[model samples]
Target: MQALTYLEEYHSFKEAALNSRFLKHKTIQQLIKKLPEAFEQRCIGQSHEGRDINLIQWGNGSIKVFLWSQMHGDEATGTMALFDLFNFLQLPQFQEISSLLAKSCTLYLLPMVNPDGAERFVRRNAQQIDINRDFNHQVSPEARLLKNTRAEINPHFGFNLHDQSTLWSVKKTGKPATLSYLAPAFDEALSVNEVRQNAMLVIAQMYKYLNPLLPQQIGLFDDEYEARAFGDNFQAAGTSTILIEAGGMFGDEEKQEIRKYFFLSILSGLYAISTRNYVEEPLQHYFSIPKNNKEIFHILIKNLLHQDIRVSIGLSYEEEPAEQGYATVKTYTIKDIGDLDHLGAYHIYKEETLQIEGPIDIYQPANFTLKKDNMILLSFKNGILQSKL
Candidate 1:
């Protein structure tokens, strides 16, 4: 029953979405104006381009939680999911959640942390410095604003949000990591202190809830301690920080489906934080989430009888901007050619008799056609490959 309610809430929110990929400062400004009287807005600081870095607050409880997304300009998935969360927060339909969240928590949201980078859809700020790695140096003004906000609020929990590449697959499964989470370690020791454990427990519950729906599509990020990262620094400052990376889903090119899981995790996290429901969760489940594996390819061809010998190849897609807008398309290249007896891919093809039709020049464009008995079976143009086999 609760799962159904969650789905219904997401549907209602998505149906009323005001913005998706083209979410800029003006869009956010106009959208927040329509928020119910419960929401309070403030200009925390200015970006490198003099854009207002805004903060929106709701609820009044002592369990203060701060969530910021799009620190990297190109990572827009979290920003979209946040607005979906905002829509759900305002609905009279979710009165029970509204009451529960309001009574026991204080939520602060900072979506689109790098508006300048978002404008260009680049990874860094306009200054070309990555905010996530600028904790001590303070190379960007946006970085300073986030540090100041953290100092001002002293939130009990911090959510360091961003989008990850679609190519990451679950270890040994070849399934895309639709969503990944991490409880940032507070120190180089990477020990699970009480504060860090709080984050793990909440994450464990989220993984438990999502595993049934997503199966092998979840992952645990490698916890190599980075002293300059916000999540690590926040954890060091005694704020339990959880990192959520929005990866790819099967056909969620716009990440609409992945956004639903993001919304669900946020809802579940708030409830767990408010109720301490995570305290009873097993820590092993947190570790059980597959470690982020970078070995997988987007597509693979195996067991093809080429010249009477089986051959396998791996192909990786590169993101290229589309003709006329902020939209982009993928262009694939042959990353490797070998006996890949172990690697997994979401899309795999097996052919009894296959021929890698010319011109098979390695430096040329990733264009090819597969033929069997003088008949074209598959053709890969640019990055998209369509196969009849």
Candidate 2:
């Protein structure tokens, strides 16, 4: 009955996380074609580029919940997690859990809210609009569709899912925040009303179940009020909206592990809501979770002297997203240079004395070279690193 044990059943998943990275519209359409007829689906709207924004509805219970993922299009972890849920519910072993959920809660899912952005594997749609930020303005068809769906369903619970940068960390823990949660503020004062408190309670339930598995990797996102964000607006409208940000793992560049955590988290939240398990929990637990801090780096270098002054550097990936018709490729580059003690790095390189060869181009790191006593320390070409150490 525990959520952790579900990991044993995940391997049997027909729609596995292993295949979900860089998922394009064609790939998703093919996968959804194989779903059982019981999971009802229909086009809620069309993207600016004419791609279908699909909604999959399930369950017949009194309380209803709505979940949407990849509104940013580049944030696909929760989308993969939903497909896993779709697969798990069909298996015989997990039928009771699914049935129990159905008896108490009805669920609606919008798996890909911005298919045009997903087609380009980018954050914005063809109109260059951010669907999440378009809530107030309804500038894009996707935003309008989400608003329409909310009005039609009137769901009691809303999960606003997204993927965060890989470098986010738990406050002062120096650990990459693997999974973070936020019960967003409905107003500028960031007050905790009943609906917002309910969302926080559910997040505490998730932390209770998953924190033991990840320890310091768990984080609480800042609850600053963003008036135009969908989660805040949804909470303002009385739905218990929870924001889930799937972040980085130490070595899991593809974030397959984080996707599994995403799946577990969703199931746990639904399980809590269906049974009213979070009704008695105090808000103290939610407030106790560490806040997510912005001080993690994928690469770090230390003590490279320039003009007799010591300097350190932090670099990041400048990814080149692939269109639906093209192969996916990501490149890393030197994004910044600083004494970044505030941030933690998964990889660190340090030395007493280092030398820079020729005139260095801060804007063009691809052709730069670092050397020490005739031995090349590192070289960058087209954002690819070559290390001689």
Candidate 3:
């Protein structure tokens, strides 16, 4: 609950330097230089592209909480939230919470694990390897650094942070899954040991604190055991691991709004761990949280006459890094066509009298226009939205 109060003034402590979703290693390095002396900063390793991978450590208690973000370089929301957290921990007015954290837990943060991927704004590293999935092979330097660091620290808890697709929606709510939490299964049996259960209990506490602030917007991510992933392996290795994913918000294309909730989740989780309150939370609370599903689209147009048959069309965009990874180019594609009256979308268009100006085909790039009595409702040229009125 205190986290909520702190969230109201999020902009006060939010790292103003890192405002956009496209975060590069250089930007993070600059922010690191500005951090107060309380944080111990050092370069632990380098990416395949020879970019320095740094680690920042704060807090001093026996409880070791290790958090790593942006393993999939393009997933920068977690990295952004982490910077906000770094700023929050140092403010003078928040000594009550900050001192408690410092006295009860030691926080180890690797904000950006794949700087090379972040440089080009791609999912994988420069070696074209998914660092998260390269746990077994340990081929990539970033993966090796992460794995080795965890082993050296042997943390009591782990926070695996990443961003999920915007299309993910809360089951039954049909709203974009703005945030999702998961206690990854350590084994194929999906069994719940004390290790994983602690993670679940912590996640339940997180859900309790976050669900109200983001009502029906947070969902439980899929728990299918990922053999080579960091969360599952960390849980298997006896560290209670929690997976926090930043999904999407309706109007927040850059996820600036979502970042606040994401920061709150992390803060609440840490507070729970610090006070050992997660032990009081019921296991049922974790199961009761709704699961995420693909029940939403980026754009939806209903009652459109395609081939003389009225149908709904769902369109989603594929983001390609542009302007040297400083921006993105969204290419809209026809994702689905048919009865989608039950689905939700960030943008919806339903006019009683409308005309289709070009071909409407599923599984292809969007190249059509919707008009209502000479008024252009929506227009797309070769998958690019030209205008909407």
Span of 10 residues, lowest total lDDT, candidate 1: 357-366
Is candidate 1 or 3 superior in TM-score?
3
Ordered list by TM-score, greatest first: 3, 1, 2
Best by lDDT: 3
Clashes by residue pair, model 3: none
Candidate 3 clashes: the total is: 0
**Which portions of model 1 miss their true places by more than 4 Å?**
15-22, 322-325, 359-365, 372-389
Give the alpha carbon lDDT tens digit for every residue of 1-389 in model 1: 15446876567777345445545667777787777778888888899999888899999898999999999987887888788888887778788877888999999999878998887777889889999999999989999999989889999988888889888877877778889999988788899888899899999887877788788888998899998899999988888899999988776767878888887877778888888789899888788788879767776778765555677877777775453326667677877676887787656766666677644434345578877788887677765666545
Clashing pairs in 1: none
Ranking by lDDT: 3, 2, 1
For all predictions, the C-alpha RMSD in Å is 2.4, 2.6, 1.0
Q: Which stretches of candidate 2 lie over 4 Å from their true place?
A: 305-309, 323-339, 351-367, 370-377, 382-389
State the C-alpha lDDT per candidate.
Answer: 0.81, 0.83, 0.92
- Look at candidate 2 and tell me the lDDT of residue 161: 89
> TM-scores, in order shown?
0.92, 0.90, 0.98
Identify the leading candidate in terms of TM-score: 3
